[model samples]
Target: MKTADPPRPRTRPKRPGAPGAHRRRALPYLLIAPTMLALSAVLGYPLVKLVLLSFQDMTRKELFAGTDPPWVGFKQYRSIFTDAFFWEVVGRTALFTVVCVGLTMGVAMGVALLMRQVDPWVRVTMAGVLVAVWAMPIMVAAAVFRWLTDTDYGVVNWALGLLPGADFTGHNWFANPWHGFTVIVLVVVWGAVPFATITLHAALTQVPAELEEAARVDGARGWQLFRCVTFPVIKPAFVMVTALMAIWDFGVFNQIWLMRGGQPEKEYYLLGVYSFTESFAVNRYSSGAAIAVITVLLLLVGAVVYLRQLLRMGEVE
Candidate 1:
């Protein structure tokens, strides 16, 4: 009877699946939490606030008139569409973006490719200089350029003084909108060069040397080798750089604001400057937000196009 009672106390082995299964399930969620938190802070908060503000009245005049934010049904949208300054600024911003993006990508690609052929020391040195220029704060860039291009006592004026028979003595670089725009473009190009160069250099390295050797073995040399082998591989990289630069320039505020557009004033204002002046100077937050929204839309389109190109290139590869 005692032996039988002892036999009844037989223990079962612990299941291997339970504790490990709990860990496996929790690990994925743990990893995902940080990214989720960052996205919530970076993107979700602003979006929620923007939607709320867009729906709000946000005007003292309405409050005084004993009114709350009536659902005016796209009234602000209509006002933006009707404004002439909006169109003018949009046109100028487009032209500026196009020029800046084109120049930045073209110059940066050439420099990157050239550096790749040089010794490692030379490559490092070159990258240092380019990155220095890029790492400069945009505000600093604009200020320095303004000084360099000033009508009097500027380096440009001094250089003109050195040149033979050049009558550029008293001409302010930003006197005209076109010159102002050009100077802004140059600053933007300088700032953008590093991003394009680094991306392109990374891409160029990924171009298989064995493929180039194969082409060389088949008598492909110089331009032929690049066209057949190197170019195809790095083309998507160029597309990405170009698209990113385009979007950056389209939403530019620093370069334009630093150039002091709308100083002397409104006739030369572009969208960024105009929007800022409206929001803070004249208390037109709705209008400013609308223009900012437009800029964001343009950037979104550029990003989409870049991704699409990348997808196509992946398929081709």
Candidate 2:
């Protein structure tokens, strides 16, 4: 009673717009400021330059003469948009991305499921092999694949030649565009599968065994058990990996270039290779920049779609 009588003014609550409240709200941004600044410093200038370059009519002449190229707003874009070859490249890139992503995810999921069911030692051995494969440099992997598909002495051709009534000996994998792409897809899927398997295996381990057992007790089996009890838990990880893989596969250049002996034919042109060819090979720098800009825009659209799907999944969960 005496303390109540002596009690003074009540403490005031902070308003949302108060200085302390504002600082508290901004603390997260403050913590991330240095990283944001660093990224801006590294990426901002190049991006600005690229965008500017896309609006200019730059060529080797302008570049070597040390003179600013004349501005030609959207002319490069107009040219490419009207070209049938560009559309073909776009379609090819899209199809390539889909196939590579599909194979990578399928093989990875199968391997991840196998890892979960196998003996611990066997799983460890498999993981070790995957890591070795993952750790191999892209250049080395491309070189190995090139040698394996070599027309004359490739082990792949030799091994297939031994099959009854089958002859793959001296088969030029890169001779036909379809066959060349198949080999490229195999190399891409091979390199891509290990990381995807490891990530998916890690995600699978997070799924509660109790839920799986409960579903099984209710007579859920095989695909039913997975669809009802397992897939939901790992769907987020799966979607993220698939989106990233698609983006990477869309930009694939090195494998095709290397496999085609650094001068990928017109038939092998993906977006990245097409951009490079336009810029350096053809001396059409402005056109290359326009293509690069279009590629970036496409990637942004994909990213937005991925984000929306992820957010929807989060909301559903």
Candidate 3:
């Protein structure tokens, strides 16, 4: 009887208030707030400014004195399309990226595979050399290459002198555009090889001994072992290395520019240097901004293509 009397006053439990629901919804915003703030401070502000600048046809005069920036929608974009220099820059950049990345990654993979048979200490020593090369600052490395490529007293030319009727020595690398381009590409390859080596070496370690043994057990030769077993496992690393190297090659301004002594020639005028000249040297803010936007778009497209290659091999296991 007593228990029945107590049960007569039963009521439904109360749900959380609107403020609690609001706080629950706000959790994601709270978590993302720092990232949003950081982006606004670092990337967001500059991007917004660049976009604003791109749409306008304002001169340096208009920019510096805080006047209302004049809008001339897509004039700069149209000009970029028409500019012969822009096309030259694009071509040079593209060529440099392709050659440097190809040479770097190819050699790196070959060397890594060769080293796989060597002792662990030798592998460590080789890795040390590559890491040493990588750790050297870009400017310092460029300077070393410049001296080694000197027209009058270069080691490369000296090495070339061993060949009869070869006048590769005393050739003006910076003076002749192709020579300059070649030397710059060589330096780029040299710089990028270490990254490829390190990445591929790490990847090669994860490749099972059993797989290679199985391939060999099937009467596979060196090439066959790589073709059937090794290559498939390291494909991801190869793609990633190539993409990053391509981006680095494209944005290579300091190396080529410094090597060529900032020459305004067919060979030295890659997109990065061109953009730099436009922005800082020529004081063409809008033009420079336009170049930057284009460069970013190119990089985005390249990255997408690179990532797609890796994604296409989905779930290799």
- Please provide, for model 1 over 1-317, each residue's C-alpha lDDT reduced to its tens digit, 9 standing for 90 to 100: 45544546657665657886788779999999999999999998986765555545456576467666555546666788898878888888888888888888889878988999999999999989988988899888988988998887788878877788887788887778788778888988989999899889999999988899989999999889878889888898878778878877887777777678435367566677777777668776666666666666767787888898899898988
Residue-wise lDDT of candidate 3 within 1-317, one digit each (tens)?
45544546667554566676779889999999999999899998898888888888767788689897788899989999999878988987898788888899889998888678799899889988989998888788888998988889999888888798887767767777777778888888888888888889889999999988888888998777788889898888888888898888888888877776666554577788888888778888788888988998899999999877877877455
lDDT of 2 by residue, 134-209 (tens): 9988899999998888899998899999899998967998889999999999999999999999999999999999
Q: Which scores higher on lDDT, 2 or 3?
A: 2
Which residue runs of candidate 1 sit more than 4 Å off their true CA positions?
Answer: 1-33, 55-57, 60-70, 217-222, 261-264
lDDT of 2 at 191: 92
User: Alpha-carbon error at 66 in model 2, in Å?
Assistant: 1.2
lDDT of 1 at 71: 59
Residue 172 miss distance in model 2 (angstroms): 0.5
RMSD of every prediction: 6.3, 1.7, 5.3
Clashing pairs in 3: none
Candidate 2: lDDT of 280? 89
Instruction: Name every residue pair that clashes in candidate 2.
Output: none
